[model samples]
Target chain A: MARCRALVRPALVEAVGRLHPWTGEMAAYALGWADPAGTPDPTGSEGKGVRQALALLGAEAVGADGAEAVPGAVAVELVHTFSLLHDDIMDADALRRQRPAVWKEYGTGPAVLAGDALLAQAVAVLAEAPGRHTGAAVRRLCGTLNDLVSGQAEDLRFEDRPWHGPGAVSPDQYRSMAEHKTGALLGCALALGAVLGGAPDRTVTALDRAGRHLGLAFQAVDDVLGIWGDPAVTGKPVHADLRRGKKTYPVLVALAGGGEVAHELVTLLSSGRPVDGEAAELVAALVEEAGGRAATRDEARRHLDAARRVLRETPLEPTAARRLDALFAHLLDRTW
Target chain B: MARCRALVRPALVEAVGRLHPWTGEMAAYALGWADPAGTPDPTGSEGKGVRQALALLGAEAVGADGAEAVPGAVAVELVHTFSLLHDDIMDADALRRQRPAVWKEYGTGPAVLAGDALLAQAVAVLAEAPGRHTGAAVRRLCGTLNDLVSGQAEDLRFEDRPWHGPGAVSPDQYRSMAEHKTGALLGCALALGAVLGGAPDRTVTALDRAGRHLGLAFQAVDDVLGIWGDPAVTGKPVHADLRRGKKTYPVLVALAGGGEVAHELVTLLSSGRPVDGEAAELVAALVEEAGGRAATRDEARRHLDAARRVLRETPLEPTAARRLDALFAHLLDRTW
Candidate 1:
């Protein structure tokens, strides 16, 4: 993973730097490196760059050197950035990573354009990448975007529904939604890596399956943290998800328990106010008592285990697979 | 012109119909045939469908039958529809063609998704079209999208910049912006038509040149009517351009003219009220007194004449060329 980062980082830096001045500025802000007006400032708001790392590691898992996969990694990163820009607007999120989200800083109109520029430029970049794999990769990326929108539509619809009440969600439905929402792109990233590495179909499928589970586990952990993690560590207040009545895995599980504590939690979510100190603790206690905390942790473990099983089935070198396993564990365990 | 409409209308209808059910619903609203919720209702708010007609006519002018050019026309119309959807959002318009705009009816997020679906589906439709020229046409359409976005960005920037104020806009800047905002896609419509018609390069160039000039003329005439046309005829209150503080050709000419009326007109524009009735009439009178209206009319005529010359130069069947020429005149002379 470290080796892949060394190779991928330079290309990303150069590609991002050499963009047309205006586009470069936009991309810089997208990457959490610049202010809205293109000033040079990094406020420690950049993501952990997990997606890029996954792209590189996936390539290595298929026996490709990181040098051959940097462009693909950059392409995936740009697409991810584009999604964040639009998602912020759609969700009406004021902050991302620790700074003003794109729409908040630039207004909805410019943010939309900036996101579009990234999307268009991502396609162009993929077209210019040195591989016949480019065509298939581009198509896959487009499909991922469609899935992203589909997932978002469903997510938004839930906000207006009574789905946040007790007994409202199921494991199957949660998994299905999360797979399309987050896992689809992660699968594409691995598939692209395999394609660039010249891996066979079976090898690609194995890597993709591994990525799907990893992404599921990653999302579950994030959702858990979003509701119960400490404010300082998560960089968002505790019970933030409850405030939005987000139907994350833990909330869904608690709702499915159908008990007095579950009823209280549902009421709290519907209250439409910020969940504070004692209330936050009570909500967390209710979530645990409803078996949600344990269930969410268990579900995360199941996905991670499934990913590891697929990793064993792939054609990756032992060292590469080991590094990937370590990366997946860190991803599942990380704070913030 | 009737023959052109006969060829293009059905094609546009079928093509738009192929948009995802939701997107098609939005298209119906854009065309003024349906409400935002996908309900069918009789309405007259549709665009004139000028771009679609031009594509089919341009194809026929170069010897192709309408049947052979349906896909080309459909592709251009989809691009145009997608642009309108996004433009309405960017312009923050409440009504389009007389009906509620897409964003106003569907919300910004859904409207954006609908626009994106149309664009993605447009690519798919173009790709699946049965023709040797399909790939090239689709690529050109993508380029046209890039141009549209660039033009939109400039337009947004223009709103806040004093240099883009009345009298500050040059003819060259006007043409350049219009070429991107309107002319490029219109030219592509003709170019695609020529491709489908199997026309030679000279014929294609002629059609493209003519389309470009016609687009400019249409926009200039639109600017004139924006401030001075009858509200009943235009379907919008008079002096909409002034209220929006748009730097249209007439306003620029009047602003450049050194006189009291020009100064008064500039003040009226900068005031940014919804000027109408008597105040609007007074502003229209001042616009004419400053020679703004005549100057704009002359400029529009120059573009119309240039379009006529392009038609004369093209090696079209005389009947077809005459038909297209008449269509151009009718469009330019339109009062509504």
Candidate 2:
């Protein structure tokens, strides 16, 4: 992961710098490479570079040098950051990575414009890529963007639906939204790298499938952490998702379980009063008693197992395949 | 103009419809092709289709059938609508074309997302154009987007600067912003059409220059209309620009003139009191008395003449050159 980040980070920075200077500066701040005044911040916290690593690994698995996939890696990262910027605005998140969010630091208008510019820059980067598969890569990237927008739209719409009634969002609906929101981009990262590396269509498709499953597992794990993880490590308040009345995986499972405890939980959450720490603790205990936590963990393991099976069947180079296996295991082995 | 609109509008509608359905519906409504419920409205209000006309005329000037440039025309129109959608949000304007703005009709979140989807769809449309120069076309389109964002940023920043101090935006600064915000996309429309029609590099460059001049003239005329045009015809409030304290071309010209009338106008505008009908009339009289209005009108004429000269010098078929001359004259001959 460190080696992949070392290869892709500079290229990503350079690509962002190529934007219009004002927009470039805003993007740099949003990406944690610079302070609000455009000064570089060497120690700024950054994301895990998971998508970049996936792109490079996907290329390497298909017998191409990882460096050749730098453009794809950079483009995906830009798109990811763009999503984060807009998502923070829509979700009204005040903090990110233990600092004020972009919309909070800069104004909302600038943050919105910065995110739009970043999306355009990402497409521009791919459109100008010196690769034989540039056209195919752009098409795939646009499709992924469409999926991301659809997923976000659905997520917003879901928030307005009744939490426990005929109009409630089903588990299937949640899964579909998750697939579009997270899985599509992850799949596109692998597919883009595979296409750039001259992989056959079948191999590219398999890689995309593996990536989708990996993304699902990753989101499932994140949902678990949202409920039960330590705030000291997670950088989020305990029962943060519950206090916000978010219909996360375990909460949804408990709601669907349909018992006295589930009914009480729904009434308590829907009452619109603040869920204090004690109430949050009681809800968490009820979710555990209903087997919601264990069921959610099982779902994550199922997807991770499916991802590993796909990797085992795919005809990747032996070293690349082993690295991918290790990476998936590391991603899924986070605390329950 | 009618012929060009006839050729491009359907393709434009089709391209927008190809976006994700929810986003597509919002975009359709924003483009005035549909209502909020996703039903088609054949008589819906539409823009003047100036950019679409430039694209088709550019192709015809290069001896290609206008239909061959339909994709370019549609792409440019999509980009144009995308800008309007975002600009309305940034400007906080509640009305567009005498109707409620997209952000007012739909919520801000959907409006922003729809605008974003439109931009991505525009690039996707260009990337899939069945032309040998599709790659170059997409690159040029992306560059134009960058310029547009920069122009918007400058426009917003200028609003925050002191109108009477050293930080005041100059006439030259206003011209640069107009060129980027308006001219860049118009030039790109012509350039994309020319490239798609297989025009030689020299012809493509000449067409781009003509389009830029035309765009500058268009914006100059628009500035005039913003202050003095008939509300019934223009579909905007009388003295709309002055009411908003916008740093339009004529306003900047007046500020730089440094006369008693200009200074009084500045004081009235900077006071931040609502510019009611009587106050707007006074400001308008002051602007005209200071020669700002006449100077702005002359600026429009200058660009119109420059665009005409470019058309005369470029080697086009005699018939096509005559058509281009008439088109430019018609565009600039709107009621003052």
| DockQ for the candidates, in order | 0.29, 0.65
lDDT of model 2 at residue A333? 82
Model 2 error, position A124 (Å): 0.8
Task: Report the lDDT tens digits of candidate 1 across residue range B66-174.
Answer: 5666777777777788788878887898888777788899889877766666565555455556766655555556566666767777677667755224536665666
lDDT of 2 at B330: 92
DockQ of 2: 0.65
Q: Candidate 2, chain A: TM-score? A: 0.97
Backbone clash numbers for all candidates listed: 1, 0
